[model samples]
Target chain A: MNEIPVGSSATIVGYTIHNAFTERLREFGLIEGTIIKLLRKAPWNGPIEVQYGHSQIVLRPDELTNIQVKRMM
Target chain B: MSDELPQNPSLIALVGSPNCGKSTIFNALTGLRQKIANFPGVTVEPKTGTVKLSGETSVTLIDLPGIYSATPKTPDEELTISVLKGTHANITQPNAAIFVVEGTNIEKSLFLYAQYAKLAVPTIVVVTMIDAIKGSGGVLDDIELERQLGVPVIGVVGHRGIGLDEIREYLECGDFQPPLLADNQVFTGKSTIEDQHLWAREVAREVARLPEMDSFTRRFDAVLLHPVVGPLVFLLVMLIFFQSIFTWATPLMDGIEAGFTGLRGYVEGIVPAGIVQSFLSKGMIAGVGAVVVFLPQIIILTLFISLLEDFGYLSRAAFLVDRIMGVFGLQGRSFVPLLGSFACAIPGIMSARIIPSEKDRLTTILIAPLMTCSARLPVYILLITAFVPNSLVWGFLSLQGFVLMGLYIIAALSGLVIGKIFKSTLFKGSKLPFLMELPPYRFPAAQNVFLTAFNRTKAFLTSAGTTILFLSIILWAMAEFPRFEAPQNASTADIERLQLEHSALGMIGTTIQPVFAPLGFDWKVTIGVLSSFAARETFVSVMGQMYSVDVSENNESLRVVLQRSITLPAALSIIAFYVYALQCMSTIAIIKRETGSWKYPAFAFAYTLLLAYGAALATYHVGLLLTS
Candidate 1:
């Protein structure tokens, strides 16, 4: 997930750990099989901005590491 | 249970995700009839307002904290869920819930709505930002949404009052029924997040066409969120924010000060020139004026905050600063409150409520006062101008200006360090994963912005104002009593000085003088420090009174008198002390209210006092060594 290029689309596969944070992400429409686009990453390994289901969310790098995703062409 | 219910005014809860225009709808619906109430044992204060449903029928509208889910993750979310479940002791279960959703992003909204539906409260779907949907070339069939979701759905541009009449009609008619869930659609309070997301997506796809990414937002984000340019833009924006507060609010503050001075003069002229005149002009008027003088700064700070928030830039700014603030164990959201502390810590501390995490919020509140508020500027200026030379330091930088800038830098550095220390010691916990919504940019609604500023300023006045006024009167009495009889030939200034020397505050200052003697502060300086607790700027006035500096004369006379009485080491020590001390009564009062306990504010006061004393002691000794 960290290596995903900006503007690339991906499908959420599953979470590495289930917790309140991931649960919140899911509630914000980051469920499995959901298509998400990597909008941009903040400078200095800061939070990554992602677009999923017409909503843009900023998630820290550690949080993004928990979610496994498959890149789409 | 039935008997416990209120006899009238059914409670309606407005629930939605953060930045979903929930507050805008709330402000529009309630207008100016709202009051914020703290729930028992929680820091979250839900705002409730009386909304007229009909000619005589009125309902209480409670605006719940925005939550991403019914399952509580933060204190705010916990409060929302507890209130909705009727588990909160102070608030009864709302009779109905108006689940506000953004029309442009209904899919994300439905996920929370699906979980909310299981609570079985009669619910209405309010799709706000409907105009944004149309502008983005998408369609929302609210009627179809209503049919699909089994609840009354109303689409409205809340800021503009469009479609508000339909919403009022629904509330007035009292026709809200519990949502009728289909067998497969029943959430059952046990649905997984995945299942809920899928269900919400299906429903949203069925009823509304999802809008494309807003072009304007995307274009703006490209520059504003750029790695280099984003932070630069953020810095520029913050510069403008602080500059406006100082530049714009100064005239209004000066006007308020002048008005109060005129009023005091008028009262003095009418009242008999004795304790009565003193009480009326000094105790009451001066006390009230001190609190009222902060109104312009509070209004401006809150107005800027509301504008940034409403325009959807605050969160983006938070994102830009998250990494840097993370190093200090503070989140990006803490930036705004800390920035606001420069204007006044009262508004800054109050604004700390925006940080969702309890520990983060508390840390921000605790460190806000360390940011060197405007109240500390007079003390800093007096000391620097008197002691520091006006000669240029680095070819162009005036030594006086450089010293002032250095004091500000020191205060900022100490704040970051103390914030980190507190986070590690007292507030240590697992860091909450930083998750924020970069809400789409939109034109800020003028009504909402002004109302927010007005309400916040009003809250400050009502809650903190009374404490400040009361303390001001008490301090005034302390300084005014124990009148001394001077010789018949003594001048008015000499008599005034003698009176202050013999007063209770003077005696206490003399008693505390030995304690601060190591820091090079004399009894007069001690008295100035003690009196400044009412408000930091009072130090200058107190010193003026102690030195008998004529009010008609400029600060030059006062500065000369101060320079003659106080040594260079003492001046440096005083500057060091003022840089760190939590001297404002209003800040302490607001902290007590915001933290919902005296414990945190008490702790804050103690730690800052110690820091101030130690810093002053160190600075005084260093100055002595350099002079020798």
Candidate 2:
């Protein structure tokens, strides 16, 4: 789903990162098939913190929108 | 311990992800035997230290910059990749690598560890934060982990000196096994991200008994990372930090001032009233002493910063403020440099080297001087004491303190505005993703914090001894030359004033008078403003000489004399001007050296001068209107 609910855990389908900067997302191990736990989304649609394995990061909301995910049953 | 090993020293690299205790480990390993220098063609200063293992067997440890992987992105990341690939000309391939992996965050740390093993260098996994992990009720089987990874593992608390002896013995032995994964199948296009994480998870599961969560740390992070409470706490903390620099530093600053004045008086009394006496007392003592008085404040501020940095709060601060700063077309990387500017712009501009993007680095450098550096402290204190009232503003906040804080706020806002303008017009580049790892907090090492302060103090003193001493001598000559005769009825103060007016400096000041006349600056203030371009702190000493040179027998301070000499409007105008002015020639020189071009510095100077004049003009006219 495009509007992935905050505080929900999901599995990554893949990413649609279009810029040179988004390649960093892959380098940071935000690749497809990893389970991402969205912890919190900041106010005013700011940075969103997500955790995968032992790594946790705060990324911009607009940037995270491109990462297509499947909500776990 | 190492007779069988080669007599020649081996080069070892200490590579780790950011905030992985790399520097702490390096400090613990090398003690005082470290040298800092920029990597060839890059501004990232690689720290090399001598790690003596035995009587004569030592290894040179090159501390590489922290990076996640080998793919080159930033200039710093590019440097690390080049050095590791054995492509950088000045650096030879390392004999071994002490790959530091944080014990608590093995999932991510081991990924980089696995990447490092592919280079075919013999590696030892130094698991740091072992104590912290054990405190949280987690356990690591170092030997089993070593067996699993096919590399030797030594768990070390780098700051506490735990496991250091074992580490020393291992390096001295110079016998390490190869990587277990010789095929390196995980990262060699044979495996996907799923396979790599699975490998890391498998290794971690075998050797580590990690708790589901460290409850104490998790609870603390709940409040600290809270959306509503986090930013408020940050603002309140920063407010107190900035205010304490002025409030807490006052008594110490006074002690230094009193001590220097006493020294100058004693030297003046012993020597005859001639050129040598004047040069010693006024030129050398007064000029350099004025800047030296601010050293206490610089130390105090840097101590606070280093403490926050060591405590891992600064990176969280970067996280909290990134969105706000990004509005100005800057990134989280600019935060550290801007914070450094609060101490001094020279180091602040130099610290901009950490920003990966050339455009972002240049933008940060150009606006660094607007951050109300400590050199501006003396001027601010002088003006605020002379003009701003000593009464309380809102119960606890003193008006002087409030005004001081106000100036800093204005500087920060001005920097943001200027950064936005530069980004939109002059140099536009794509924004890099903000991805910073927030390291777990640890108690800061007192030695490391003090060493950082000591280094800053040394750099400040070196500048004061050389450039400041030279400029003060020239200014003293300018104010003391061409012996103009005074009228018989002229008072001592008037005679000194007339001498200053007709001397070489006075002629230059008068020539520049018309240019500054619209801002209500007299020839004397013009002289102070002109000399300050070499160094901002020189303005205070220049004014001290101009106003207090054999003028008064009363116990009146320079600030008192200045209060009588200038109007409130003029003082306010000058303060406004200094807030925006690029009054430091050293900053300009460093920018020129860093940018490798005259155009950027020239542009920076012209734009800042224009902004300063415009701001001062607006303040002057506004003040006139309000009073009238």
Candidate 3:
């Protein structure tokens, strides 16, 4: 998921590991097959910003690394 | 469910995701009739307010911390879930719930509502920010929404108080019905999370005609969130934030100081020239005046914070700083609390409750005091004016201003460094995931901003004022007693000095003088440092009392007196000590309350004391080397 370029959309496959945090993401509508767009990445290899289901969320790179995604663009 | 009403005042819970305008709606409904409700054995305190539904009909409203789902992930979510489930010891089960949903993002909002449906509690769905949705050329079919969810739905511009009458009417009627899910199988019989999202999206599609895009938030975020421009704008915003607190508050602060001085003079004139006069003028008036003069700065700081928060810029600021904060082993959520510390540590410490991770929250609280709070401003200004030259440096900035800025930078850097150390050592753990929603910008409502600033300032005054006033009288009595007669030929200044040296506070200072001597602090300065534990600004007032000078109008006379008696190295050392010391009693008490244990506060005090002493000693020696 972190490899997706900015301004691109992708479909979530599933989480590499499921925990409370990932469960929360799922509850926020990041369920498998949901499409999410990578808005931008913070400078200095920081967190990445993404939009999923009308909600913009910022997450660290490590968090995004746990999810598998197929690029749509 | 029981058929009869539970009690006289039905308890209603307000639940929503963060940045859903839930708090604005709460403030609108409750106005000033609100108080913090603390649950037993829980650090999180949900605010409870009385909402008047109609004539002789009112309900107790609990504003729960925002959550994304019924499954608890954070302490805040745990508390909300427990209270909603009627398991929290201090709070009764809410008779009903008001589920707030953002009109602009109904699809995302409805997902949470789907999860909440399992609770089977009667709920009224409030669609807030309807104006924003309509302004962008969208429409919400409330009747369709009501039919889709099988519950009452009301649309409201919360801050503007539109569509609120219908809500009050519904509540007053006391006929709330639990959501019926007979046809909504997407949420029935242990459905998967994906099914819930599908149901919410389908319902939103039918009931909400969303605009093609939210161009307003996008246009602003283009610049505000740009990789290069975002940080620059953030820095500029911070620059303005600090500048207004210090420069803008000067005139008002001066007026307050002058008023107190005039009051002191009037009291002294009416009272007899004896212990009574001294106590009235020096003990009560001077001590309280010294602390009260900083009120303008506190108000300004709170105003800026409230405006930024209400306008939805705080979350963007947090987003911009998340990476930088990660370097210090903290996430973006720590930014707001740390920023509040610059105004005062007590509020800053309390605001650390927003951080979801326990270790991160504790570390943030432990290092919050290291930020240069406003209480340290007077001490810094007094010392800098006395010792630092006033000439311009680099042909533009004044040397004193430069030094002041340098001190602030040093304090901030030290706080970051200490935060890193604590995260690695005492609160060692893996880095937690950082997730935050970037709320869309809105024009802050004027009433909410001012009310927030007013309430915060009032809390600060009442809490810090009483402690300082009590300590001031005790310090005054110690300095006024055990008086000695002046020699026939001695001057008034000599007699005053003699009386102070013979007093109990003076004797204690003399006895402890040797311990601080290596740091270039004289007996008088030692006394000031000791008294400062009551509050940081008290050190300046203590100096004024010891020197028999009025610091209310200006510190000019006091500065001159200090320059004559204290060496340059000593002044710098004192400034260094003030910069590092955890000297405020109110802060310590608050830390104890927030952390629910004395262990952290005790460790904080001991470590800060050692750091202050060591830094003062190092600074004193450096100054001596440069001078010699």
Candidate 4:
């Protein structure tokens, strides 16, 4: 999960959304069972853009580190 | 229908997710008939417009800040949520609400709709971007959606006049019923993010037909979002943006300056000599004239920015720069506000509302003024022209232009350094998620771009007319009072000098001379710096009036007089000072308005002025050392 291949599609299994910024990610359709595909990862493990249900969003690596996802092989 | 609903011209709150085309729909609903103003005690502008209902009844529409859910994540979202909940005392609880959703992304859009439904506010869901969804081989069943949600759902292509009549017809009927779902079911459904996602997805499945891939968007993103190529492209675009501000606006600026000069000449010829003529020709015309010349630069800047925002490239640019910015502990969202600061800090600070994290938003606001705003341009150009030689380095770069670019670079570096310090010390340990959405690129609509540019230009002109006009008159009187008698056989320069020396401004300048002596500013230069506090561009006008009187010759430009009088060290010091100083009163006033506290603006002023003084002192000594 830490080094998932680029352009891989995954199903978010479980994730920890911190209290300080809750509801924002969910509002963008990033939740458990929501299928997401890594569209592009910025250089150096920086923020990456993902396709989340007909929309694309950028997420910092630090924020995504805690989110558990099962890559669809 | 509720008997308690307000009579004719009922208030309707238009809410939606960001990039859902809420503003476009607002434009569609209201046409060229909206007025934008801030909610009380805050800087978020709620655009209000009136649209005729069925026959003759017109209803007021409040276009709220875009948010994903009723739960507030940012100050702007809180404003929307509070207003809907009837807790925001500034605005009345809306009689009804128009919940706009992106039909292409119904899964996420319906989440907000469900949240709004919990309030039982008689909401109508307006599905926007229906054309884009259809183009991408997706289907949005509006009738099915209407039946499932128990609310009126109308698909609309906001830019074109699609499905607008249906919306108006619904509003005109004035028969909005509360959503069919019970409050408990709407608010308490499984009470988890996963559950909500599942619920929204199920609803979307029942409503939407099919969508496999976003082929067109992905094709563009493959090239535009490439790691190596994307950043280079973004840099090229920005270079053009910054370059145009200088090259493109020059002619328009010249035209404005010529017009002002002509007016001043006409006034001087017609008005009787003495105080009346001097005040009208020199004080009023010259002072505001200098500020007005900057109008073209501000317009060109916002015009480019609005175009970028409209075309949906700004968010992608933000994504590209986020990593570099994150290294300095600033979120990617900070990029937009910082770029906006280059045109003017007022809009820059206002746009900080987009940043989700309070800490990041605050830090961005604190450092935004450090970005060299357009107001500093007049002073910079004047100083650079007067002191810096117009020689080319390496046969490619003009020295003056390079120095101008150097000032911008220095200001930007200062913001990064300041941001780093604030991150580790003042705004510590707030780990807010940096999640940014990138909307698909589209050609910018001309009307929206023009409207944005027009609004910003109008704001600038209005401020000039009121604040700058008032300050000009006051400073003029200060320099005009306490007239002195000229000695026999005295030259016109001597008489002018004597009058200024004896005037209130001159005395104040002389008194403050010692305070700035360490920075190498003389009394005359000190007076210019002092007057600039009202508005930064006023520095040039103050200098123009102070020096124009002594020149005597009509053709001798203020640049020559400045060159002859001021030393290189002093001019450099002034330029360095302006690079960091928060001298524009409007910026401070806006900071106060946005943060809803004088403390932040006070801190902003103190820190920036300290930075300015220290930088100026260092620059003066360094220049002296190198020259000697």
Candidate with the greatest TM-score versus the true structure: 1
Which sections of candidate 4 miss by over 4 Å? B1-9, B54-56, B183-189, B287-291, B340-362, B373-405, B423-431, B463-465, B485-493, B534-572, B585-602, B621-628
Residue B93 Cα positional deviation in candidate 1, in Å, after optimal superposition: 1.6
Question: How do the residues A1-73 of candidate 1 rate in per-residue lDDT, one tens digit apiece?
Answer: 8778998999989889977677777777887899999998888888889997678888888778889999998
Residue B609 lDDT, candidate 1, scale 0-100: 97
Cα lDDT listed for each candidate: 0.86, 0.76, 0.83, 0.79
lDDT of 2 by residue, B1-628 (tens): 6677643438878888877888888888888787765344555657788888778678889988887765567766667767877888777777777888878788777767666666767777799889877888888998888877878889998889998898787778766555766574534663444556567777788888887655654565677778999888888777767666656777887798788889889998999866688789878887777567657666876677778788867766767777877899887668777876786776567657556567888899999988988779878888898899899977888999999999999999999899999998987765565666566666899877876676556655564335556656777788778668889897756766777778787788889899998897988899889778766776786687678543234324887888899988889989998998988765765676566566887888999999999988889889888888
TM-score for all models, in order of appearance: 0.95, 0.84, 0.89, 0.89
Candidate 3 wrongly placed segments (more than 4 Å)? B1-9, B38-42, B181-186, B287-291, B336-362, B374-404, B430-432, B481-499, B502-504, B537-572, B589-603, B620-628
| Candidates by DockQ, descending order | 1, 4, 3, 2
How far off is residue B336 in model 4, in Å?
4.3
TM-score of chain B of each: 0.95, 0.82, 0.87, 0.87
Give the total clashing residue pairs for model 4: 0
**Between candidates 2 and 3, the TM-score winner:** 3
Model 4: pairs clashing at backbone N, Cα or C within 3 Å: none
User: How would you encode candidate 4's per-residue C-alpha lDDT over B1-628 as one tens digit per residue?
Assistant: 7567634438998988888888888888887677776555765668888887766688889999888777786767888999888998788889888888876678877777776766788778889878877887778887888877887788898878799998887778765656665454554656565666677788898888656556766777787778999888988987787667766777887899889989998998889868889988878897788567667776877788789888888888888888989889898778877876886777677667667677888999999999998779878987897888999999989999999999999999998899989988999887446778888777777777877777666755664345556656777788779878878897756676678777888899899899999999988889888878867887876677677553334323888888888899988999999999899766775676567677898999999999999999999999999999
**Window of ten residues with lowest summed lDDT in model 4 chain A:** A15-24
Candidate 1 regions off by >4 Å? Answer: B1-9, B38-42, B182-190
Candidate 3 local lDDT, B1-628, one digit each (tens): 4657533438889999888988888888888887766456666768888889657779888899888888887778888998888888777889998999988889988888888887888888999999988898888999999988888999999888998888777677766768776345645664677888888899899998987557888899899989999999999998888678656877888899899989998997899867788888988898788568757876887788789888878878888888889989888879877887887787677667657677889889988988998889989999999999999988999999999999989988888899999988998864336778877788999878887777666655665566556766777788777777779897656666677777887798899999999999988899889878867887897788678787767899999999999999999999999888999876776677677677888988988889899999999999999999
**True-structure lDDT of candidate 4:** 0.79
DockQ values, each candidate: 0.74, 0.50, 0.68, 0.69
